[model samples]
Target: MNILILGSGGREHCLAWKLSQSKKINNIFAIPGNAGIAQIAECTALPINKDNFPSILEFIKNNNIDFTIVGPEAPLVEGITDYLEGNGHAVFGPSKDAAKIEGSKVFTKKFAVRNNIPGAKAYFFKKNDYEKAKEFIEGLDAASYPWVIKADGLASGKGVLICNSRHELLEALKDFFIENLFGKSGEEIIIEEFIEGFELSIMCICDGKRIIPMEPAQDYKRIFDNDKGKNTGGMGSFSPLPFVDNVLQKKILERIIFPTFESLKKEGIIYKGILYGGIIIKDNEPYLLEYNCRFGDPETQVVLPRLDNDLLELLVNAGTGNLGSTELAWSAKKCVCVVIASKGYPETFSKGDIIYGIKDYSNKSDTLVFHAGTSMDKGNIVTNGGRVLNIVSQDKTFNGAIEKNYNKIKNINFDGMQYRNDIARKVAEK
Candidate 1:
């Protein structure tokens, strides 16, 4: 079957790589794919975005693509699935209505309340109601020193800020409401009470009814090591978290995932494709932090590597609502994905620097360098975005996987490359 994936990041590259390995797949394509994806699938250089849906539809038809999978949230939030399905095409993603769970934090918060889904305590405030927001924060005791201030709309993972004090929370609000730091994304805000806990990602395949949960993966969102600094998409990730036992998994499925599915159903929206739960576990209980309509970036880089089944067939069946009869298999090996980013990522950084030492990785066992922000410039691969590449490796043990990944990561270098050295350190120690 001919498949077309949308996006130009490591997640899309991993999906393309997995699909290329499928025996049933005849051809695969990616729109605006990075350099690494080009190695496995036909990378079509198209300016794909929300407004250019018509052009993408034409491309799908011309290429005779049997299935189209969206890898990013932007297009899904912009109603790409509805547009494609309306035009009689097979597409894998949630509708614009269903995507609100990821597109709008305020929407998800309200939905969570209505559905009795477990989550952190939050209060909604619009830009015009700045005084109300300040008053709400002032009302909180000193115990809530670290407050989570989030922009209601998507801001590429930088929308949420953890304020260490009242002064910081006030400053963040001023930036959002007064300074307009995030533009339209910050027009509205959600001041959620901060919950201290270990975070993990739970991705599931939902065929609008039955939900098939994948293995748990924990990602380090902070830009620096030891979980410090601002969030930048994600820094690194690992699968088979030592903390997520059967009890915790069952709680997440029953308390969060099921209600989320039922909530979407109540709204008359059949949520197909991936439903990623950004969860925080505290006191042996799970709390929903956020949701992504599609797959997680660095998390997918690690999770997909541990899959023992054909990814192409699983996604296709889910897209067609035939996933009830299908089952997925996973390898026992632990997987780790360390993100290589520009030196000053999540802030200011340089691009166009020549990257080296990736081509040699093909000879390495169980190691894959999935490109995130890269492009071929005059026969040389160069950095093109903040998070550049994902160094993924798998082994029988989590510590072994982490060791193997970091060893190979040292060989690959760009002018301003940076990565976390202690990825999955806490979990691996246990």
Candidate 2:
């Protein structure tokens, strides 16, 4: 089968890498893929964001591409899945209506509230509410420090700010409303009471009817280790969190995950594709942080490698309603993923820095490198975006899985490559 994947991040690289290993696959293509992906799949230099959809439709028709998978949020928000399938191509992301689950935090808050899903209480605001927002923050002086302020729309993953004090929250809001840190994305805002807990990403495949959920993975979103600094796209992750035991997983499914699907169903939107449930697990109770319409990035690097099932088959079956009878399989091995990010990331970061470790991976059995932001600079691979690569390694033990991989990370070199030192150390410390 011929397959086309959208976006050029680590998630796409992992999906491409995994799908390429499928015995049933004939050919695979990545739209504007990075250097690492070019090694496995046919990297089509099409701008997947804008003009490529029309070209992609024609290419799928001409090449007999059986399936198309979207890897990022932007195209999905533009209804790329609805278009591809409308033009007789199969896509693995949600429709535009379903994509709203991720595209707009305001929309997600409304949907969750309407459906009675458990989450932090939040209030929305427009640009005109700057004064009102100031008053609200001042009133919250009696509450607690570190208020959570978020852009109502998508500003990548860094749009959510966890401010430490009323002064800091006030400053952040000023930059957002006045300095335009996120432009129109911050035109409207959602201020919520901060929820402190361990965050877990639970992703499930929806076939527009039934759902096939995958293993839950935990991602460290803060830029620094020990959960410091601002939120980034994500710094690192690990799979099958020992924290998400059977009891907690069951409760989360019943409280947040099931009700989410029900709400979308009530709207007549059949969510076919990945339903990403971001849960803040605290006090052994799960609170919904957010929902992503597709798979998580670095989390995918760790999780997909442990998938013992045919990925392409699962995606097609999910799109076709055959998933109801199918059961997904996973490897017992523990997977750990560490992201190599550009220096000064989640802020000002330089690009075009030559990265020199794509081929430096050791001869380890369960190791794979998935590129997030890299390009071929006349032959040498170089950084093109903030978080560049996902270094993944697996083992029977979680500690053995991550430690082995992070040691190899030191061998790799780039001008401003920055990564978290403590990935899965929480589990390690335990």
Candidate with best lDDT: 1
lDDT of 1 at 52: 90
State the displacement of the C-alpha of residue 110, model 1, in Å, after optimal TM-score superposition: 0.7
TM-score for each of the candidates: 0.96, 0.94
Candidate 1 residue-wise lDDT, 1-430, digit = tens: 9999999999998998888889899888899898888887888888767679999999999999999999999999989998998999988888899899899999999999888898988889998999998888778888767889999998987888989988888899999999999999899999887898888889999888778889989888888898788778889999988778899899999999988998789889899999999999899999999999999998998889888888888888888788876677898888888999996787976789999998544523698889999988998899999999998888888888888888987788789799999987776855
Once superposed on the true structure, which residue ranges of model 1 sit more than 4 Å away at CA? Answer: 360-364
Task: Point to the candidate with the largest TM-score.
Answer: 1
Report the C-alpha displacement of residue 406, candidate 2, in angstroms: 2.5
Q: What is the C-alpha lDDT of each candidate?
A: 0.88, 0.86
lDDT of 2 by residue, 1-430 (tens): 9988888999998998888878889988878888888887888777766556798787777778888898888888888988887877778989988999998999999889988898999988889989998888888865586678999877887688888888888998998899999987899999998888878898999998887778999888889878898888899999988877799999999999987887788789899999999989879999998999998988898889999998888998887667868887889889999998997797877788988866544323687788888988877888898889888989988888778788778778999789998998778735
